[model samples]
Target chain A: MERRAVFKSRWLPYALIAPQVLLVFTFFYWPTGAALVWAFTLEQPWGGGSAFVGFDNFAAVFGDPLYWASVGRSVFFAASATTLAMGVALLLALFTDRQLSGYRAYRFVTIWPYAVAAPAAGLAFRFIFASEAGILAFLNQISPGLWNPSMNGNQAMLTIVVCYSWKYVSYNFIFLLAGLQAIPRALVEAGAMDGAGVLRRMRDIQLPLLQPTFFFLLVINLTESFVDSFGIVDIMTGGGPAKATNLMVYKIYFDGFKGLDYSGAAAQSIVLMVLVMALTFVQFRFIERRVHYR
Target chain B: MLYRERMGRAARIALLAACGLVGTVAADAQTRTKFDLWQGLSGDLGERVNDVCKRFNESQTEFEIVCTSQGSYDAAVQNAIAAYRAKKQPTIVQVFDAGTLDLMLSGAFVPARQLMEENGYKVDWANYFPGISNYYATSKGVLLSFPFNSSTAMFYWNKDAFAKIGETAAPKTWEDVEVAAKKMKAAGMECPLAIDFDTWQWMEQFHAIHNLPIATRDNGYSGLDAELTINKTKFVDFVKYLKRAHVEGWAKIKTRATGATLGEAFASGDCQMTQFSIAGHGTIVKTSKPGMNWDVAMMPVYAGTERHNSLVGGASLWVLQGKSKDEYRGAAAFLAFIAKPESEEYWSTVTGYIPVTKTGFAAMQAKGFYDKPTYKGRELAIQSLTASEVGPLTRGVRLGGFLQIRKEVTDALEAIFSDKMTVEQGLAQAVERSNATLRRFEKTYAGKTLP
Candidate 1:
């Protein structure tokens, strides 16, 4: 039975929640409202004044083919990064949950990469995968012109997807591991006594029970990969040898900050936010039905 | 209620003390009239800027110039714009060449001529080389900003490598460059010419030197609604030639994409010849291998065409408006001090930037400054800048969204080099994209015209 606490003083409860409400309003709602206004107006770069353009900025943004290309690239990046991140994290979580020897150290090591900031990780990966004078340089000696990410677009995409997945894998592993541990140990032992192998037990007992955690990670990773891959893309590809890696978030930054197109970038932000919100809504409405919860 | 009253009294006492401290600081600020200058470069160049401020500070007691580096040119301008919006902008800022139009259109600064003349300084505006001044001046021939850290493209060749390939002098034309590259390759030089595909070096500078138009309306100096002309120029031929060079393996790509810059590739002797700014002279000297012999010359022109002056690539100083009288005086004084021939020589000597005025170049020559091995070959930059009269097409690009245009050109180059798009297709596509950007900029400032 769930117990609910009743407040004797109605005003006291409102006061207790006021700070949180104020923070959300100030940080999230205020900036979002400002972005909405900016999206419909033409902003002067030097702040002389802005004019009300009324959907003109959005019209311009949607009219550009390059903007649409960025949307496609961002979708590809998010899907690839999320699927790769969750698969790797689930694998590692499964390994650690088996209570193998030195599992504590392995768990600690797995979680360590999550603490690294995104850009720093991107820079480290950039040097490590550098074609000419990096750890991968030996591949060039073995097969000349084989490991050139700077020239090739597919290789460039793979590089960022790998880097972003590496960073997020640790985050997913922690959650998945906790969820794995929450399952009663007797459930697994029970499946094993029914003439089932380890993989069989994992498929029937562990996999079905872990669906809730998997669904939660899926929604979080997909939404975050849309926006949070900016640092990785900025450091590694910088939107490309041919705009191959120009994700929507990085494009927004480049146009607004470097190109000084404020209204156009604001329109891009609105599109990105709407896209992410729709994605989350779809995942909850359809994908959540398949997720089994106790 | 008694405790709260006691706490309020204590807080009021602290606030009074804070106000008193602020008053003293404000009084000190008034006495010195310290003004801010936001420069766009850092490291060794930043230290040189700091040294200039220190020298100026020591020369006077009435005003102090506080110089700060905002990392890169993009950051400096972006931060300055933000600061302007907040009414906290600096007195002076260093803006790069591409930003000239945006600043010129924004009406945000006091013209250098007006500022200098108002401060009782007789600036010989004509003495500023036409090639340098034309880039910063208005259509009415009014100078908009003070030229600072000026540089132009020059061809840097490895002397010893050229000698091994039986070349006695640096290449003066593209055919000569190709001949030298072929000879070097035969002589076991793997990467004969290192190319970075920098927009300023390849697209803009190439167009300027070839006396070709990059955009209509005299490269956008005539109007805000100017369109691009890069597709209808000799640039298409240059791209075809570059593509051929890449296919033949004589021109090796050297940029951050390849994990080595053109300057680094030259310094390490991985490439025999490079085309970059004269400002790279100092760093190349320091980083080159011991006993490595190198010299620089003016960039090559096509065999049939007359070579025009190459556009200056570095930044210029703009005196931002809306500062106090004392602050403006301090800024004018600092500008005057830096404009003297000796100060120009000192700046050029340390930083490898060419002196902006003819007098500074003459002063350096009279003193045999270029005869020194450390400073040799840098004179070619000045020669290249003054190679011909500043033609309408060669003055400089003044279009808004020029930085994006440069990026578009770079993307075109990459696509061409990768064989994903033909040279003609890429150039034409880039011109289309650039025109779109221009149209958007035209809409942003609908009623404004070029000053």
Candidate 2:
């Protein structure tokens, strides 16, 4: 049965949600509006002046090769990090769902990492995977000059991707575990009575039922991997070693804030916002068709 | 009835005392001309800046400065710019070296010389060190801000490690450093030298001391029409040399990506030598391993290159516009106070930043401050800063959009060092990008000439 709370007055529901409505308008809509305006305008760093140059900022941004490179890196990072994090989380959730020994402890331990902040996680992983005098130092001893991320572009990209996935794995696990538990036990028991092995039961029943959850996590992971990786990228690579990790978000910050090219930065941000939106739309339009929602 | 009357009397007495306290607070606020000083340092350095304000407040009674830290240099400049837009700016803000040119062209400051003169302070503008002061000065040598927390790069080397390679002192030339690094490498040393990726040390300092122009038109001091000439210069050769050194297994990069800082690496005795700021002396003293013997020398140039003055690296105090006359007086007084010889000595003793004036250095020398083991080798920074007369090209860069330009150069270094691009290709592409930034900057402030 669908439940609904009836309001006594027309203004009651509006009053109840006014705070949230105000928050969204203030923090989200206002900034997005301002960025839209600033995208077509040139702002002086020291104030006192501005000029509107329609689409000049956008044209400059689109013409920049470095900007395009950052865009490509961002897309690659988004797909790689999302798949890696979600895959690891699904594996963890499956093992724990099997009711192994100390499953409760494993569940509790898994959620602890989600509490660790992104920058803190970035710093922790930065030291652990450090090329020299760190936990991975023994690799360099085996083959001298083999493990330095500072000099290697691909390795630098891998370092940030791994650190990004490590933080997000814990987050994805909690949701996947809940989705797995939401399934009816009787269906799985019937499949087991029919002599279906564990893997077969999961593939035929559990995974098919987990589609809605999978779609939900996919949207969040993909969208979040676009913008939320700023802290990790900043702390880990600062978009460096030849700008390998210079994602679009970090570039917007570096250009807009540090470089004080507010117009250029605002334009880059517009491009990033459009990219995230297009990604979400594509996922819903294409990927959601095959998702069987119960 | 009697108890109620007594309570009323007691309340009246308490209210009278509160009124009296408020009166005194109002009077104190009115008598002193209060102004805000937004500094861009924190932690130990921030404490020292606050302590300087405290000393100034104690030294006089006419005015008060409310000191606050914006946490970092970039934040301070950003906040100040934003505040200026809102017409809520502080009277005095600490702007970093890179921001000097940007602030200069913004036309938002009262020239330091004119402010002092109008405030009745007898400032010998020539007393400021040429190397330190020129960065914040106009094309004709008029200061636009007061040099605060000045420092320059020096070659830091481990004497103990160099002893293992039979070299007793720091290298004075690129050739000497190469020989020492190769010998250290031959002696089974894992990492002989570590260089960070900051363009300040590797590019600006390298070019400044070798009497080379980083850009045209006296590095943008003359006008706004200057373009980057870095690619056509010897920097390509320099990058190639560094690349070769890295390939030959003698030089190791100790940047943030490496999970170690250049200072920490040298301090921990892992890297034998590095070129970093003299201000890093404080960190080296605190973080160096036990019983490690190390010293610093002026950054080495090529063997045949005649040494010129290296540019300043830290920050300076810019008196922002739109402040009242009374606040200007207070700012001038504080500037004069910090410019004192004794104040310079105290500041350097506590913060490892070398004094920015010749008289300050002389006073420290006369007081035998440099004779102490803790303070030894710091005077070399002052010597390096004043190695020769300030030439047209050696007066420090005054280009617009310098922060972005520096990033381009660093990106070039990264690309070249990572083998993603050849030296000429990387530097040429960087120059092209940097020139575009300059063009945009020039367009932003169209028709405005350099001050």
Candidate 3:
């Protein structure tokens, strides 16, 4: 009788969830499947039907050095941005979790950058980094022979990395702060009673407790870094100084929208989607097991 | 039951009255054929268009013309295509020059010549400039679209910067330009010369000025099977000059996407000189504040090659298919009204676009409008654009998928500027890639050919 009652309750909830399930399938899954099909065909809007080319588009994508170069740059940007954002957010969250004065103000200020749109942040970075009359240029005017990324590729990439980190660190910090706040205070007190130092308490208790949040953050930050660099690269250098900063999404945009190579761009997009999905799956399968949830 | 019957009777009476009102409205709607116009011009130009449209709407009782701004040229084309697919396309759309081939191939445009003839409007196609009309017209010399807001390239310079560099006249040739650039650099200016450097301006005008083929078969006007021929010595020399300018700090290359306004940049003395469209003259004048000295000049020519005139750059109005007869008449009338002498004069004076009709230019000239010092050397640009023979290369590029090909050219140029590839290598790659694009376009648009 209890099993029957439980089954009946579940059925009601499942019935309640049916609409959302159908919505997702119709909107997301259906379009994604169609795009996957489109990736293999030569399709034009008013032209005749698309034909199956059997990996020809994919082969073209793989053969192009520019595509691979963009992939490499995207990986570099994502890795650098994700690492910097996670590290800075962790530090800021630790600092804000303390019983220090004006912590609220610091927290508010730290989280403020998150409120700005990604494109607006890119524009701000461009103004700050512009060579002719940027803030950095003004600073260089006073110092003479300071860092100028406008004419240098490595320095330009560094500037992009720094800008990406600046824009996203606040978001990670917000998540980390919330994660830290959720941990019981007694755990830290118990560690203190056991004669653990601040670093030990953080490393052993706090980090372990925040592992689940950290994993979620790690995935989110990686995706954000991979995807959001498109706007930054477009607004900042437009993959300039010899394509130093052309990320995958930006390349897709250029090929698809700007260059009007719809098939080529769709193929590139499929590859990118597969790569991201594989990475995300690996993160979930292998990395999630290591994330402890106390 | 008696109360329910009474309520039903009252509801029936209300429904009958509503039907009668709707019947009148439907009759009114049937009497007036409404035509939708999608355009990209905004600000003052858009307002002028609206004023003209308002006059047209008031001048007729059988048709109503509604105009809408659809953001940029590219956006307008995209929206038109999407709407075309949905069978809800507008009656008329203003497409940029780059979008011409795409529209021509789409087979959705109702040729303006046919529309005008069918609607009983008199169109003297011969009165239009041959060089300009040939670009937007069919091979049989029929106008496919109304030529509106046509412009050619012009050089703009800061007089103050020129004085500072000890130069009193505009550069007349590429060699002269190089010399002036060096002088400007010596005078402590960072960017002696800057150009928008768009693919259309740099490559297209390069071919135009040098009388070199940008593509085979008269830039694809003969057929769809044309290939790119822009990898010759003339283009190579041009790129080498640009590279030398970059290396020596005589010129600064900025992306067309991110570059500030040429006029504002020149006025502020950020750049000593710039090459841009004549259509920007109005903005140049407006942005040049009090005591700021700036002047217009003809585009510099290559020293050795035969100097051919530049082609038009702005958009033309295309009439779309699937409009009612009355709406077509209204569109033709609106076109004729805008093409009238007084209207063209007012438009040219307000905006910097050239008058489409000869009478309009004569009217402006009769008023001694060019005598104003502020308008100094403005006629030189027009005269230069009208100079010499309309050579095969200088006529205008009409290659299918020209827009995409231009982007590839821009990519190649950017690669060269960023030192990823040498000018020769970039040009070679650009030619190869552009040929591939042209081949694809030919395959797709097989039977389409210019008359």
Candidate 4:
């Protein structure tokens, strides 16, 4: 049976909810509405005098090959970062759940990376991968031309991906661990008694029950990798070694903030917003059907 | 006894209140007009800017200038623009060479000449170096921004590193530089030369010194519709040479992503030779170890062509519009102060940049400023910048979308160095993409012709 509290006075409920409604309208809907309007116009670089250009900015953005290249890179980056973060988080969560030696320390340390800001973590990664003085500089010591991210586009991309994933792993770990703890111990034990090994127990009993959590984390991580990778990209490679690491989000930041092309940036942002909305829609519409929520 | 104690307490309270009132009134009377000056210099140069502001503040009681460092040049421009939109802009803003066109077109600036004249200060515009003035002046030969901390690209070499190869003279041309690099490589120097990520030093300075037009219509000085002629110029050959030098392990390219700068590489003796702004001289002096000897020379040129002057590389101070008359007067007073001969001498001595005024140079010369060991090679920068009569190409490129155009050039060079694209392909792509950006910028202005 469902329980509900019916307000005796309708005005009381409306009064209580007014602040949140006001906040949502002010912060979210207002900016979104403004961006929607700007998406169709040509804004003067400074201020005042914007003309309605009707999709000209969009046409220009879509026409650029570099923009398309950045889009492809963004997709690859988000997918890879999501998979790596989730896989590592799940593995660590499982191992720590066993309460092995120093499990408390492991638990604390696993979630500590989330406390670091993205740009700071990116800076740390830059130091770690520096050409001559990094810990990985030993790679270059052994082979003179082997591991220079300064000149190698592939290495630069990998560096950014690693930096991005490292920050997200802690976020993924918390949710996965909570989901693991929520799994019935008796159910896992029954699977274990049936001669199903640890992997088998995890696969047959816990994994299916964790599906909803996994899907939620998937959407969150994918959205974050798309929208939140700018700091890492900015501090790590600045979207270059030849625009090889120019993710879509960084491109937006670069074009809007650095290039000062507000209308173009606004149009690109609208496209990105629609793309993410469609992605979230697909996840809810199709993928969520397979997720087992208790 | 009770009445006497109450009276004493009342007397004490009255005394405290009287003191407070007097203090408040005196403070109000002595308060100076606070002028905010935002610049983009850091390290020693940043400190020098602060010191200059302090001197101005100390020299007068009318206005107190508070100088704020805005980290980098790009950040300074972006922050100033944002602040202007919010109507909270500083009275004076320092914008670099590339940003001049943007600030000029923004119409948010009060011409420095107009401000000085309005405030009844007679600024001797002719006293400024023509190369410096030519870069910041309007097409009608009006000074829009006050030239400050100006520098130009020139050759810098490690004397000790050159000594190891029995070379006592700086290379006068690119061929000599190549020869020296080979010798330095033979001597087992890991990096014979390091190049910065700034394509301005390579394309603009190189093309200007070679007397070749970087773009059509007199290097974009004639009109805004100018297209880049960089790919057709001999810069392609220079870039190809640099690429070959990289492949041979004799050159290093310092991307902004890299934790190290070209200045650091050269100052630390990791690289023996480079062509960079003389402003980097301050950093070299601050960071170099006791025995690391270095000197500046005229920038290397191509084999047979006669060399011209290099263009100015540093920033200038622009007076923002939409300020109170008092604020404009204060800003004008500050400009007039920095332009003084003594102030210029102090700035040139501290920052290693060229003095902006003729009187300043003459003052430094009279003081034997160039005779000092630390300033031994700095005169070469002045010579390199003012080597020729200020020509249209040498005045500087005033392209509307210059910041984006510069990024395109850097990205292309990076592509070439990384072997992702051939030199020809990379430069051609840069030209095409930059032209598109130019078109977009043109559309933004609608019908206004570039001055």
DockQ of each: 0.52, 0.49, 0.19, 0.45
- lDDT per residue for candidate 2 within A1-294, as digits (tens), equals 879888989999999999999999999999999899889987778864678889999999999977788899999999999999999999999999999999999999999887988878888878887888568878898998698877777888999999999888999999999999999999999999999999999999998999899899999999999999988887787788778888999888888878888888999899999999999999999999999888
Tens digits of per-residue lDDT for model 1 on B327-405?
A: 8988999998888898899899889899999998999999999999999999989999999999898888888788788
Q: How far is candidate 3 from the true structure (C-alpha RMSD, Å)?
A: 8.4
Better of 1 and 4 by DockQ: 1
- Stretches off by above 4 angstroms in model 4 are A1-12, A189-196, B1-30, B42-47, B256-259
TM-score against truth, every candidate? 0.91, 0.92, 0.87, 0.92
Q: lDDT tens string, model 3, A1-294?
A: 344534446588889889999999999899678778768876554333456667877887786656788888889888999999899999989989975789999998998888877666777877777665566667567774364565457767887898889978999999999999999999999999999999999999899999999999989988878766777787677675556777898878766655455676788888888888988999999999988777
Candidate 3, residues B155-230: lDDT per residue as tens digits? 8887888888787888888899999889878878888888644776677877787778888888877778889988
Ranking by lDDT: 2, 1, 4, 3
Residue lDDT tens for model 2, B277-377: 99999889888999999999999889888999998889999999999999999999999999999999999999989998889899999999999988899
Please give the range of 10 consecutive residues that has the lowest summed lDDT in model 1 chain B: B1-10
Global fold similarity of model 1 (TM-score): 0.91
lDDT of each: 0.88, 0.88, 0.76, 0.85
lDDT of 3 at B10: 75
- Estimate, for each residue in A171-251, the C-alpha lDDT of model 4 and write its tens digit: 999998999999889988888788899888888888899999999999999998999999899888888788889888888
Per residue, candidate 1 scores C-alpha lDDT tens digits across A150-175 of: 87888889989999999999999999
Minimal lDDT window, size 10, model 3 chain A:
A1-10
Q: Which ten residues in a row have the lowest lDDT in candidate 2 chain B?
A: B1-10
What are the chain B TM-scores of all models? 0.93, 0.93, 0.88, 0.90
- Indicate whether candidate 2 or candidate 4 has the larger lDDT: 2
Which docking class does model 1 fall in?
Answer: medium
Evaluated on CA atoms against the true complex, candidate 1 attains a DockQ of 0.52
Q: Identify the leading candidate in terms of DockQ.
A: 1
Regions more than 4 Å wrong, model 3: A4-18, A46-54, A139-151, B1-32, B41-62, B139-141, B164-167, B187-190, B254-261, B324-326, B372-378, B400-404, B446-451
